[model samples]
Target: MRESQPRESGAQAILEKYDRESQFRLNLGKWGLIVTFLGVYLTVFHLYTGYFGVLPSQKQGAIHLGTALGLIFLLFPAKKGMQKHQKTVPWYDIILAFLAMYISYHKVIFLDSILQSRITGYHPFDMILSIVGILLVLEATRRTVGLPIVIVAGITILYTIFGKYIPTQLLSHPGFSIDRIATNLWYQESGVFGTPIQISSKFIFLFLFFGVMLVHTRIGAFFNDLAFSLTGRYTGGTAKAAVSASALQGMVSGSSVGNTVASGSFTIPMMKKAGFKPEFAAATEASASTGGQIMPPLMGAAAFIMMEYLGVDFSTIMLAALVPAMLYFTGIFIGTHFEAKKRGIVGLPKEALPNFKKLMLRNGYMLLPLIVIVGTIMIGFTPQRAAIIGIVSAYLISLIRKESRLSLKQTIYVLEEGARVALPVIAAVATAGIIAGVVSITGLGAKFATGIIALSGGILPFALMLTMVACIILGMGLPTTANYVVTATVAAPALINTFGLEPIAVHMFVFYFGIVADITPPVCLAAYAGAGIAKANPFRTGLNAVKLAIAAFIIPYIFIYDPILLLVDVTIPHFVLAVVTAFLGMLAVSSAMIGFFVSNSRIWERVLLMLGGLLMIHPEVYSNVAGFLLMAIVWLLQRNRKNGEVSQSAAV
Candidate 1:
């Protein structure tokens, strides 16, 4: 219960540190009213677009960016907790807000003429505002998403301007002029209004808004109760429940830290109270929550963007994500089971478990919207349409269930919350648009890919390793949308365009690594959030999280080499083989990491499990046999050890 509450200053501080949306807001009557109006205005704009139609991509993205800027300046202070006026907007932020709106309005009204003149080139007003607009995005992003992405975006812009001098042939470009760069970035759909922001504006925001609505219906409570009922009575039950509950919650929420904080509040405490160590308890929640972004249907907004990029449908992605998602959670489940076995931990008391049948009967309606989203996506509907219908279904079902019903005030609050929550993503995607634009204009993507491939001596495995390290480093301090867009823009091209990996496979490969950065060391925000709740060390929680999530690191490569794992180019036998090998590989790796099997594993068993996992995971028939044989050997060793203990116990 104490973990569930943010009363501890440490948790509050950690929340603010990792989650930009969790910062202190000045709760003034007048200020709240203005913020509410701004928030509702954004929600209405998106809802109207989602239902009727969206504006031109350029116009839509500009308006979206402008509204987000105004909200960020008002809601998030330039410095944390440094509001100059308690109940009033600071003069500078107000100026920036109006400037953002002014640029957006001009872009919409004069955009046609500006585009026509771009060849002949730039009116004085166009150039000035373009400069201002670019700066505004960087500053606003810094105020919202943090300095890492802004720094990355700035370096990209500077590279666009100065790339001709890079001397290295592979990395060099003839370079783009300031006016040319500014025009493309500000006006064209290829730049600040590119696919990334377009997806965020048109698709991702609807999902985020729907997510807030989903949360309001108390679906999270249903998930938590369901997890407890299913797993709370077994060994390591609470930790297993945490894994299930966090993964379920993460699937829709798409934010690793946000999901950790939300469900970790409930699951982390239960885990610690059930005799799990604080850091491991926190790590379990952190890793499982990170996996949610890769969960199908929503996949935390990246799936929709991938659909747009790959020119495929959401159904294809949902199908592809199925095996990987299952394996990811299964690995965590195995880790928790072994942890429980090693520590001799027992489950929560029977009284603590919810009555499964009654609970489902009473609350199952809350889950229908998820089904609606999945069904519609599979049954020939666009994802946007699917999301819209799903949201409406949720609303209708809520009216039928009084406990889940949204009062008029509650509805308004959710709307405001939805808009506020989406600001960080909106800013991140728009800035990513700048980077994407530069990549496009300079042909930097192809060149960068060439350099990386050449550096790896054209070896695919080596290239993948290089790409993974790049993703992890760049992914630090960046949100998922921005991280995915950057990697998809630059790194994905190397695999697909140059080296000829399957497009979807390469994209997914980049996405998985990018997402794992949230749980990797030094800048692991999700693990930091878990540490906050468990009162554990941040780096220690991150280390444990990486250990538990080893499957995420290894599975992408499995699907990449096999493709059968993703159900691509596979016979039924091959599909089944991939599934069996992948799961067994997961089992081996997890048991190796946890240092337990039939009982506590020996050093040899751990090494055997590690090698078996690597070999089995590679998808080669011979390697699978060798891997299986090695695992069987380890299994027999463990069995013999078990018999020796049993005989000794009997003799005693």
Candidate 2:
């Protein structure tokens, strides 16, 4: 076997550089032990609550956020580039850490009193804690989630406190007093302890915990092996396998950058060795990994929040996501396929490929946890209940192989790792709650929606384009949960209220764009992470990722114009017809984007193919027919030219 040290160290460096959550102090001996204990305790607490009954919303959110705040202060440095040399927690961070705990838990300690004082209002001390608590949350958020979300939240708070002085009548609010803002944001369930955190505390954490458990079982390896077993011997097989593996791993890995580095570390090297260009290799992985957020079941922990926002069950969200998710992957898959063919990149030799049947026979049980979670949820268990069963199932399944089995110490480590992995998400959700709280309090969501509609001059397509832009901008800096929260709050309403679109469609629209931000140009972190592994240019990798995942950009509009693509109120015939046409549309578009279809496509052929794809994807009978005709014309021309060449070669 290859010496794993180089790859391991390289991936670690890339992760630390790209993913802030991975940048943390380590090996501080006693401090590390304390951090471990806190992490384990945090996971166990959630596991206990998930199995038994959860605490009241305020109490649950408080404990969860409090523990996370403490962890964040200890594990993450206030500044970047300090993790490598830091030996001990600073005195100030230690103070801030403890204060974070106390301020966050003050609500849990005085729940009854706080409730009693709802009408009478908060005491001076209570208000002081509220003020400090908000600041601490913001600071911890800054440390773990990066400063953009903090800036956004900070701006929102400023708006909340000073909106009355705004010059514009449309955007202005009556404004709020400090006490009111503090109480609403801190003490009340509407702010730091609001729906976003509540879901994070309740559903997302366990799913994250479950994901961590899978990590310990080496399910990631299984996923990679499974993908390779299926796709490794086909044209451009390695790249296809990367997409397949990343999609599977990305759902559980929770972050696009994390997934890209984890899978790309292995896949990118293979692609480069297999004759693919470094930029294309990195782009393929980045695009595929980024799509993982749109994949069903976890959807990067956004599905649970969507359930709450759309007032639908987990199953509905899953079903709604299924088609678009598939289309997104299909786009990337086709891109890889075409690139491989274009470059004459063959699959790995058949002798080197794993046996699919044997691979599944040995490790197929690893899939049970995901199946169990989905099955239980569909059968009426709460997401928490389903996740608990999933975690337990994952543990039990891991024991089937002695190699995968966790010793007591390792199991404890898994718990600790689960909490540690969840810190960024916890901070993000809590901070997102601050943003959501402001929106709800100031009626900003409605106004923002109205503004978008007005700005688009009431054109649905234009409004969608604007909403997509907003989602991408917000998503560039926000975590998945935060991105969804903000967009769903401010942007979703824009499409829904004006266009009277299905709620799920509008929400999915924002959800899709928010996720693609990780691969979109400028600040596409997932692509950058992939580029890091592939030793390619980050900006070029990002551009390639955008090209490869172009369907992601187009699919949202397709669904928005035709909700049938989302499986919203669809009939069998229509659903099948929609899927078929969409796939065809994607194929033509993918070929056009790649400049290859049947053969090396001419520029005019690519243009016609692109136009044909858009029309076919539009979901009208006339356009579908027209698109088919145009695509058919290109196919014939390319085929005739290729056949003529073949005949000429044969004669020679």
lDDT of each: 0.86, 0.89
lDDT of each residue in 1-652, candidate 1, tens digit only: 0112234465556677788767635543355677788888898899889889999887888788888888887777788666424556677777887888788778888878977886787788888888888888888888888899999989988999998899888887888888778878988788888898899889889989888878888889889999899998999999999998887788778889888988888788888888889999999999999999999868877777898999998899989998899999999999999999999999888887998888888887778999999999899987778889988887888787778789888788788888988988888888889999999999988888888888899899899999999999988967777888989988998888766788889999988998999999998999999999999999999999998999999999987887877778879988888788888889999999999988899898899999998888888889999999999999898889899999999999
lDDT value for model 2: 0.89
Clashes of each: 0, 0
Model 2 over residues 76-162: C-alpha lDDT tens digits? 888997866776878788899889998888889989999988988789998889889989988888888899999999999999989
Candidate that would win on TM-score: 2
Native-to-model Cα distance after best TM-score fit, residue 344 in candidate 1, in Å: 0.6
Model 1 lowest lDDT segment of ten: 1-10
User: Which 10-residue span in candidate 2 carries the lowest summed lDDT?
Assistant: 1-10
Candidate 2 local Cα displacement, residue 610, angstroms? 0.6
Model 1 has a clash total of 0
Clashing pairs in 1: none
